[model samples]
Target chain A: MPCRMTSLHQLLASVLMMAGLVGPAAAEDPNGARRKALHNMVVQDCGSCHGLTFKGGLGSPLLPDDLEGVDDSTIATIVLDGVPGTPMPPWRGLVSESEALWIARGLKAGVFQ
Target chain B: MNLLRGLTVLIATAVWCLTAAADTALRGTGDLGVIIERADGSACIISTTERAILSCVDGLGDLSHASAVFSPDQRYAYIFGRDGGLTKLDLLERKIAKRVIQGGNSIGGAISDDGTLVAVSNYKPGGVKVFDATTLEQIADIPATYGSEGKLSKTVGLVDAPGRRFVFTLYDAGEIWMADFSKPGAPAITKLGTAGKLPYDALITGDGRHYIAGLFGEDGLAHVDLWAEEPVIERILDGYGKDDPAMPVYKMPHLEGWALAGDKFILPAVGHPELLALDAVTFKEAGRVKVHSQPVFAIARPDGRQVWVNFAHPKNDTVQVVDVPSLKVVHEFKPGPAVLHMEFTPRGHEVWVSVRDADRVDIYDARSFEKRGELSLRKPSGIFFAARATRTGL
Candidate 1:
């Protein structure tokens, strides 16, 4: 009875989220088309140096394992203000703070795929 | 008993010597080809004479932006991996002869004109390290640091020119320096100041007269005449992209793939879906051809009649072939998803293209534009030929 009740609750939550009734924060990305484009950029453009599969290449790995100790804020900072004296160029001019934060969180959650 | 034992030892020695002599005879210029693969960092030693793939060897690490420089004889190939692994592979044995981790990160490398020295451009330590070509021993180290502050800068556009000089651009320093190795000991450094804001990549003219550096921070390119008495730096295509809004550059385009067809130089316009034609003699823009997306490589055919161009991600599947004379896109084809590289055979009879997402390399007849054959590979990218050894700055 308890398991059934938990399943019902989870199903209701998913339905609400899909219906845009829950998670109002997701609506912050005003343009759905722009968000899709950014997601593709994260996968393909970032994939250039970080490996197509997001394993690692000329740049370090962005997988959850490699980014374990690094927090989302620190990751966001590095993405916005790149590390100096390195091949990583500054993306602050191109990536906004909100978009950078979204990228960092997504990378931490292994969303590159 | 002593006589019998002596005879057996003599027989064994004779057989070993005969096998060694046979191997030496089989290894020649005829048995030369290059196989570039990124399926877990490995290469297949190809036999050009037989026109077939030979042996596949493993252990090349992190092959993103990977490149190989062949020896003068084309017997040994020095593969530079993205992880700073410099592996010397012997084509005869189909194995790695020697390997060393020169730095924590490396972009690419070049070999001296005489084939005596091998130099690598590093990203981690931000310098150029030269090694003995045969022995793979470190010979010299030149850190890319300038100004009174001694700040180290990431090096790019590393290439070897005539007169025993190695030239490269410093990203952070915004300068170009030539390391003259004509004399012994430390190389004489000539710092040609401030090439541009960000010189991403560069290539020497096929004639080996000019070294052009592509700028990322600005609209123009920095041009240096290697043979000039003072080697003055000139900027070309000034205000090329000044009027246009910046497009999202998913991957940086390499200027090394810029093609020189007759009097014209076919180059990708930065952050633009167009390919610009520059006059090789005047170093000025001649014309432009619109393409599918931002061009990655504008490679010219051997006869210099046409240029085959590929685009950056999203539009990578499409390839446009431009007729040099008219400066028009003559043909457009979609080979497959994630097209990575294209290479023409020595005589430009057959052109090979790598379709990474499709797991096949398509070979097309140069003139008729018909599919000839295909080679199955795992995540294939660059298709280098043994003929590259005959040229400079490959």
Candidate 2:
């Protein structure tokens, strides 16, 4: 295996930044609860297995750094199309485009309901 | 006809919804490509060569060094401590759900062989947080010292004891603690006499009366008699002696990695740097195996034939191989630098090695020691693998 020296904390922070949830927690949304609700839905519904608080459980840690900068459209595709060859099943028919956006934005906001 | 068709549409949507949720819940890290168990009950190997991170419970404070082994029971991997912090990873929805910060930088943790209790090693403030495996709710907090020790300094390992209290050792400090939780609130801790120098990790024999720790400051391993009112240190390894290397700067000898094999204690030495066998009873040297020139971790494989070692590897990388019965190096390779920790899955099939400096995890086949898959993650330390979670039964 290739020996690569790296700091996990720095690497994780960077991944979160790339995910677009970086930079001072997104200015603390004026409608915090509403946004949190959206985020919380993902946790309550999805977290039943993954984890309630973020970072992980049955699911993987969806750090903000990984989701940042990607357009909502792509996020929608991931939810709708789903990543294959893994456990992630597609949410296409079950979730509407807007619903995926809600989860994406909640993911972006970094606050769970 | 219209109503019937409408019902069919609703049913189709429901089925898709269930599949979607199940699949999403079962989503693969999809990135690592490692074989996390597939839907068919067969193993599916991922193409990547990086190993996966095995974080038990990751603490927030300096005790973050404290970690617990995580199970795939859809629960958070908690960093053990007095009030430990929980590591929340949701593999299904594919994201970190949330971090439930708890208390204490407790030491080692044990999930009953059947994965029932998350037994945490509470050091100073000695106690174990018995949480409902599935609910994450604190069911019982069993303590050693009859609940007297301050708090363990993030260096304890716990083992399962049916009739007696589970056993644990305070690695940095010098003490082995045992407490029975079968009755809960009134758990009594038996503090064995301090044995060995800076006694760290220890193991209780199958009978549960004998305990031993690899002494860091001392010359060899020490034996603790758990059956006695106060545990007694009855044994030491005649491996090598600490000597002055002429220069004023002392080359202090240290010891680590003491594993259990049948009824014998397989202890490794620092000076001679050899793997020596100790007769648990007479506390006499039973046999010796001259191991790595710079032997550090002399981890004996379960079969008692091969002791895997990282004697030589690149700087910050680990070069490991299985030392067979004849003391021959079976499989060898440079998995990565600073191969800090090596753990084999229960079945002894996959050897998950973590390259702390490499910021990567590498998985290899135990038999072949061939690189099977890999995980490219940020700071992939304390790597762990839960029984593969699949995209079904959402």
Candidate 3:
């Protein structure tokens, strides 16, 4: 069972890496709990303003096509600093820089749709 | 005799099928309710007959916010969408009666005290628009123009007060205005300036005596006494969040959900992880009940014994039920990943909670805090019951 679970994890990592949803370095972190929590935050919390499907409700869409040509750093900055004069509030206190980058990458890669 | 027996069996079968079909149709007169399917941009009318789930009628509006005001007879629902689309939905027919683009961006609206007028507070045109409830025809347009430049500011926290008046706060301008339609033709406007900085939301008391607005640019709330002839304005809960620094506010704390549990008002504290209880009559601080995270909706059960609170994001999964008298957290449960809104049965025996991420609505015993049942839904956000039909400010 342990061997089968390890193989499944490896397969998931390979697929995510190929799809650019996760970088190779971050995949080695072995923080499944954090990833799950962040996934929940991106889909449920961020999904409040952005639609649950990330198709844009009050905020703009976070779909991969909508985020085309938007760099990782810019996305990360928006996640941390937020857009002023808008409903989008900053997430710096809630998420760390690396976690924000992970969310940005996942959003850009259409990981949460 | 055999032929008669056959006819009887056929009649029994037909009666059985008819009964089953009637059970599905379930909705009796005045039992229709609407649930906000935010993702689908539609409001699903569920039959509150036996708390049964029905079907959704589509094409409500673009990015439909959780703002729905029912008609006086509880037949039509006035929904204000985020993209400035105001659609009137008929609950009985389960169809959109009329829709209009009242502004470029809008938040929420209110129905008049007499229920003859429906008013919408706008974010784009920065004003309030009043329409006839029956025809959906525009009657009055009052802009929230500020200062010498006459620059408009987004209007928020709109509530229908007594005496045919709609009271709201100008968000950017930090002022509260009341438009009285009592005399007809044109609405007489009264502006109370310098209420505070950046008033985000406002709420009027059930008696329509006090109109309070929560300020986002400042640390306190502005309370206006509407019954007074001169209309005295006072700031309550001053320096409530002055010591705390600004944090990431994922969702703005809603003042509308501030619960009136008996004489005490249970409000979600801004920039803090606590629920502030204040004396409803005096507007003085009563007690503070600390919760899991920044509380969004701190609503009281109908009996006013317990206050159920759903927090802002990151901790939105957990709902804490606070004992009103003791001011303690009694029962806390993690409903799902994204718990959006909750509504109690008319008597407050059952609380129907919408778990958005779970794609279901869970019914819980309000007293025991036990899960009773669950129903499958699609991204349900707000669960508004038909009991709001008789209430003044829901």
> Each model's DockQ?
0.16, 0.02, 0.20
lDDT of 2 by residue, B1-394 (tens): 9999999999999999986775555343433222221111111222222343322222233222234444445333333322254433444433444444344434445554334555666443544556554556665665433225654333454665545356666554556666665654656666665554455456555455666666545566666666676556665763345542211100112122225444445554543545666665677876766544445455555455566665422222544454543444566576665554565554456667666445556777778777787765433333333432111100
Q: What clash count goes with each model? A: 0, 96, 0
Q: Model 3: how far is A44 from its true place, Å?
A: 5.4
Better of 2 and 3 by lDDT: 3
lDDT of 1: 0.78
Name the top TM-score candidate.
3
lDDT of 1 by residue, B3-78 (tens): 9999999999999998678556765753456666764687776654444566778898867667888898888888
For model 2, fnat equals: 0.00
* Overall local distance difference test of candidate 3: 0.79
lDDT of 3 by residue, A10-112 (tens): 5675478545566647554336777777776777678766755565654676867688899888998999999875657888988888778777777776666
Q: Model 2: iRMSD?
A: 20.3
Taking the tens digit of each residue's C-alpha lDDT, what string does model 3 give over B82-126? 767788987766678898888877778999978999999887777
Rank order by DockQ, top first?
3, 1, 2
Best by DockQ: 3
RMSD of each: 10.1, 17.2, 7.2
TM values, all candidates: 0.80, 0.54, 0.83
